[model samples]
Target: MSTVNDTKFSFAVFFLTGIPGQKDVHVWISIPFCLMYLISIVGNSVIVFIIKTDPSLHEPMYIFLSILAVTNLSLSISTIPIILGIYLFNSREISLDTCLAQLFSIHFLQCTESSVLLLMAFDRFIVIHDPLRYASVVTLPRIAKMGLVCVLRAVAVVVPLLFLLKRFQYGRANVLSHSCCLHQDVMKMVCSDITVNNIYGLFVKILTMGLDSLLIFLSYVMILKTVMSITSHTESIKAQNTCVSHLFAVIVFYTPEISLSVLHRFGKGSFPLIQILLGYITLLVSPVLNPIVYSMKSKHLHANIIKAFFK
Candidate 1:
């Protein structure tokens, strides 16, 4: 019902979602996110540096792994700093422009991560099914192109959501349960009809989240099939070893995300703190685990991280 020109440019809005909690709650939560952010940056940075610097890992799998690590870095960089500000300053306020921009970047990084994950799955499939062709097929040019595609796909759709949001009237201002900007938070105040927004969001989930997950599942299935066909026990073991770490990282990252979605929809009576913690665990906390999972599973990476820290 609202027009573009009628939408007000919001000054600043508070971000404290849910009923305000005690000082101890803020301290405890902030400390955890701060530490996780530090670890995530250092871990993902070293993974990227190692992948770039080491000639031994110049293969397609490691290249995609490096890309994934970098994407995680992007995710962490955007979410954690704003969250830290909200907690430390006790000021959850964000400008309307800033909020939309943050939403844009968050979705961009998220979609990029999802698409990159799918591409990595395809990379695994190629490595397993046609090891000889992987280096040529997933070359730097192709990888770069795929990266562009992923980022473009992400930005293309999310930018429009802002226009859609702009069509809504801001009946209320500055009431967020969480520390950072989220789609649900922004939409909560819309006095106009938001059924279309919900539909668009659903479509996105089905296409990006659901479709990407299916491709990843299929890629692993093909990979498992190819692995099973290998006769040499030692080579078979070595072949599977390369992909197992990536597989583990994927499971850890997505499982919590899926669970959080289901819970938020189904668990209406859940406590405020519990819901907040789960949401953060799904996005912010999950990223911290990606590099750790990779390093723990990769002997070379584990050794390098340890050596780097010690030195």
Candidate 2:
């Protein structure tokens, strides 16, 4: 552990980071993450461009898709650049301020993306349950308002949580086990009592992750009920298909996130290598999976993707 210098410029935070066992292992890990990062950038960039350029896709769902694409782009960029930097250079040292900044941005963007997904759920519910009045209800002004609210919600919730975390006094150890600065890894550097931080972390998970997921589940429940009441078999089938892609994307997003959180809390120090490996894998998989999942499983999105590519 390094000491925090009283003089600002003299301060250098040493991170506790893991190195791949062999050169071969480093290459293997680096290769996949590199590919995922590339594909995610291209896929998400195309989605944003297509949505912006296509007049027909000016609807609520496409707008949300565009939002998700941009979020995914930023989220993955924030993570992978640092991850790749570590892998290539084996640099583990990070300043306290830099680590904290990374922690805040990582959580801020990731949680913002999750909030957007919740809004997408509501958008789907409106489209399916009341298609007749969908246009009237989801007017342009209303869409803008909803978008603003979602942004504010994510910032409002995550900003305070992160600011509160900065209150914890930290030791000089800045090395992280994983590529990027995960909250848990950074929190472990705290020299002060972390009771307040832990409590607040719990509150954030309950409100942002737990509560958001619960609401998503409820939205789908209501969506299912509404679908069932309709006697038209084809309509129900279409509704089911429309939801399947989103369901896959949601599962891909939340399952690994929750698993990583649980593993950090309970499985610390038992298998650090396994944990870091899984952390890197999850970070690579979650954002990249969305575009692939949507393209493969969603006919409408696939068509749009094809048209965009060809054009």
Candidate 3:
């Protein structure tokens, strides 16, 4: 039972492996990763810019979406330096402090994104169940407050990881499986008892991702119930259609995340490169696709996007 107070490895350094076993193709692999990162930054930036300029998009749904875009941008930005370092420069050595900082930022952004999605779900619920009060209930101040809470909660939950990780003494090879530093990946290198790290990691996952997912599910269930009660089939379809983009966004965000989680926890037979691919997908897909999905699906946003580009 190694306690956190026993060891303090403040200055340890870890080497990052860029797609283990596929070292020969790292440069080739980096092509797509770089492309995706570029697209995500451009796409999400455009979304945020469009939302800020268009007063018409000053609604709760778009506001929450802007938060998601910002979170995706943060996630993409946080990983780029280290990932690109591994792929392009073969610079795999990262200081302990840098690794911990990256780990915290990555998870914090993930938690914030999850929280934003939950707020989006709540927005949909209000719009469906109480359309009359939608504007009043989801006001600008309230949305701003919700966004603040989301960010604050993410910070609060991830800050403890810094304390927990600092206590571990990394006596192993100190090599990470992924190009980017992840809490689970880093914890595996520690020589001391990792029971606290494991438990805390699980607790954070359940607290942030687990709880948000459950609420989002329940929201959609209620949304479906409301849609089903409509007298006209066309009306029901129309009501459900509003959620199509959000549903796609949710699927895009969670599928890769769940797959990555499964790979890390249970997919021992899976190749290391396969896990790394999933890691890339988890980081890249949502950020790249989210703004595109919203822009293609929302007529107002699409029009604004065109106007912004051509005007």
The lDDT values for all models are 0.76, 0.76, 0.85
Candidate ranking under lDDT, highest first, comes to: 3, 1, 2
Candidate with maximal TM-score:
3
Deviation in Å, model 3, residue 30 alpha carbon: 1.5
- Each prediction's TM-score versus the true structure: 0.88, 0.90, 0.93
Candidate 3 TM-score to native: 0.93
Candidate 3 Cα misplacement greater than 4 A, ranges:
1-11, 267-271
Could you give candidate 2's per-residue lDDT for residues 36-109 as a string of tens digits?
A: 89999988887788778878778888788788888888888888877777667666677777776777777877
- Name every residue pair that clashes in candidate 1: 13-93, 15-92, 16-176, 17-176, 17-177, 18-177
Off by over 4 Å in 1: 1-9, 12-14, 18-20, 263-274, 303-311
- Model 2: runs farther than 4 Å from truth? 1-12, 16-20
lDDT of 3: 0.85
Worst 10 residues of 1 by lDDT: 10-19
